[model samples]
Target: MADPDGNVARAVKLETATISDALDRLGIVGQCYGIKGRDPDFRMAGRAFTMRCGPNSTPPGTVGDYIDDVPEGAVVVIDNHGRTDATIWGDILTEIAHRRRLAGTVIDGVSRDVHLCRTLGYPIFSLDHWMRTGKDRVQVEEMNCVVAIGGARVGPGDILVGDPDGVIVIPHEHEEAVLAAAEEIEAAEDSIRAAVRGGMRLDEARRQFKYHSLQTRKDAE
Candidate 1:
């Protein structure tokens, strides 16, 4: 029997592409589309703390009011309905999140004060950055619930792995299998490269490593 061993959070070198491949083999739709890193150089991995937002009510509402309650080392995942016109995050949140050692943040919509994030090296991934605020436009509807990011559904505590390529969620229930598959895929890919370096033809090296089927379903393998 397998269980999520917690190493995925510590394996900073695991690429989103490899994990995505693992998800594919496992038949899980964990790949996030459209949402991307605020800075291509930024990479992060952590369990999620999700927030969902909706249009403000007649009385108006606030954005990012629940940030203070988030615990350390959790990636703050926000769902803003994919709206790109307004922003839900900014410098103050970034400063605080950084000081608290939070893992990072990901938004289905836009974020503001990106300069601060870049300066602080605080990882943030979103549709884009804008100057307009969402204070009166969007309101937090819930916390730690299932939320959508780039068409992918993320629940509280799902493992979020992100990098220059993009973000991929590892559903909590499948993390162990996904991590095992990803590690295997990475090893096979590495072996192919090492074989080539030893003077083997690239095609021969790939054949030796069974590279094409590295991510094939285990049942089929």
Candidate 2:
């Protein structure tokens, strides 16, 4: 895969808002809408291990069996078609993932027993939470494949950065460019803040840093 260590290390330090701005500047659609952390304190950054689920088959397939194969520092991304009625993740998976040192879990659907995740400090992001199980309701249809979560396309190994605000996906191919752009955006914002603190007018600080055009696509300019 990509240089997981270097990229993940860089990504973890950035806020999702900055990355989203960079993506916008690059004309990339990456914001994962409608997905937020179970707890506002939850945060994570790592490569994606994608999973997709659908209605159970004739004999029914399994859910969460692929957890064992996930590598450390990888984020488990489950796409359940935004089904809030059934839960495909629960406390047991949370405990295991925590113990296994996985970065976190993001579900397009809801997860049950959310208290355990909070107690363990294992970051879990989803649309919502419900208690009903998906044992025979939904089955894993694919693993390590391209999946859609929160209205964004997530391919296997895509970088996922999440914070209190939300999550954003960065395709591997755009990783380097996105990181560079995000860092630049962050630096400019930091400068603006410092200027404001130093008694400069807010409008003047923003103008000096070109904050208004920071997220404008280059080609569109």
Candidate 3:
């Protein structure tokens, strides 16, 4: 495992493997939803620096300007407040983001440049896809501020893990503890899996290892 500060510095270096391992161990949901009907396809790990914007606040120049400040490999998480009139991300910005080595982006509203983003192999999770530009409708209000996604409060420096499972925000203060707990959970699960493969019943393996008792042990420790 990487040091906390190192993990923080190389925020995008953490992989879906580590995150999924953590999620399995922790038994928590990580993905957020804004799109209706279908779940978004995203598979990148990131550290968030959230953004809040409203209609008429996110002009092209402003969006470009804000993205320039993001560190390399960081994921830019945005809360557009469900605005569907104007798109928050598009081709030009996506190109810039890729150049900056960003892991990906997640928006609580709509976005444009889907084909470009897809071609670039950059994952983008958004409310919807559109062709209308974010011209006079959106504006950037704040960066590195707390924003709500799928009812969860996300703050700057939070570990943003996304995969087919969706996105989950690991609080900055809880990162180390959560990662450690997740690791332990993965080890136990591996043992359980091996037992099941060797003919032990699933329930028997779980009971033998006290898998369900993890929370109590975690809390006590």
Candidate 4:
């Protein structure tokens, strides 16, 4: 999450777990399930550039050609209905995205050329990987549109935070409040850790921080 400015900001430190907790506090369902980072240490934060994929309408419908249109710092989120038999991503796309310095790509389908992604340090979160190409098996139905990732709807410009734990999509309209909630959750967890380090029992530290309420809904509170 480290921005180039070295601001030591929460954006550079919030984990998916904390963000997920924040979403819970807000009664939002956004955690993308089954998508895993290619590199466990990889982390990314950026606005989503969403696209939808569907079975080839024609026998040989071509795969998407929208990668060149993606802006820098935007994450590519594609919905392929969690299909692992066909891949919507490959080494060429990985190389190009790395060169463009895009945040990352999240796929509801598998990807090919996983080794290239790892070697290039290009971050990708996906259901799995395989050698099958998606060129004719699937095609982009639309771009900058609503898409699903692990059953979670994602739209263009939505904030995407991903890490080893997984990816979470924050609705654009709720970004501010979600960030605030996440920061608060992170701080409370830090306090609990600090107290534990100072010889307080784990239970005592959690109790002091009201840890159990960290993800409690605001309405319930």
What's the count of clashing pairs in each model shown? 0, 0, 12, 1
* Candidate 2 residue spans exceeding 4 A from truth: 1-5
Clashes in predicted model 1: 0
Cα lDDT tens digits for candidate 2, 31-112 = 9999999999999988999999999988988997888888888999999999998999999899999999999999999999
Q: Which stretches of candidate 1 lie over 4 Å from their true place?
A: 1-4, 219-221
Q: Which stretches of candidate 3 lie over 4 Å from their true place?
A: 1-4, 8-41, 57-61, 214-221
lDDT of 1 by residue, 1-221 (tens): 11156565444569999988888887789888998888889998888999999988989877767777888888999999899888999999999999988889999999999899999999999989999988888888889899999989899988898899989998988877888889989998998888888899999988888888876776776
With a 3 Å backbone cut-off (N, CA, C), the pairs that clash in candidate 2 are: none
Predictions in order: lDDT:
0.87, 0.93, 0.70, 0.86
lDDT of 3 by residue, 101-143 (tens): 8878888877887888777778887767888877666778788
| Top-TM-score candidate index | 2
User: Candidate 4, TM-score vs. the true structure?
Assistant: 0.93
Q: Quote the RMSD, in angstroms, for model 4.
A: 2.7
For 1-221, candidate 4 gives per-residue lDDT tens digits of 22343222345478889989999999998999999998897788787889888888755665657888888888999999888888999999999999988989999989999899899888899998899888878988888899989978898888888899999888877877888999999999999999899899999999989999999999999
Worst 10 residues of 3 by lDDT: 31-40
Best by lDDT: 2
**Which candidate would rank higher by TM-score, 1 or 3?**
1
Better of 1 and 3 by lDDT: 1
TM-score of 2: 0.97
Candidate 3 positional error at 172, Å: 0.5
Model 3: per-residue Cα lDDT at residue 47 = 81
Q: What is the TM-score of each candidate against the true structure?
A: 0.94, 0.97, 0.79, 0.93
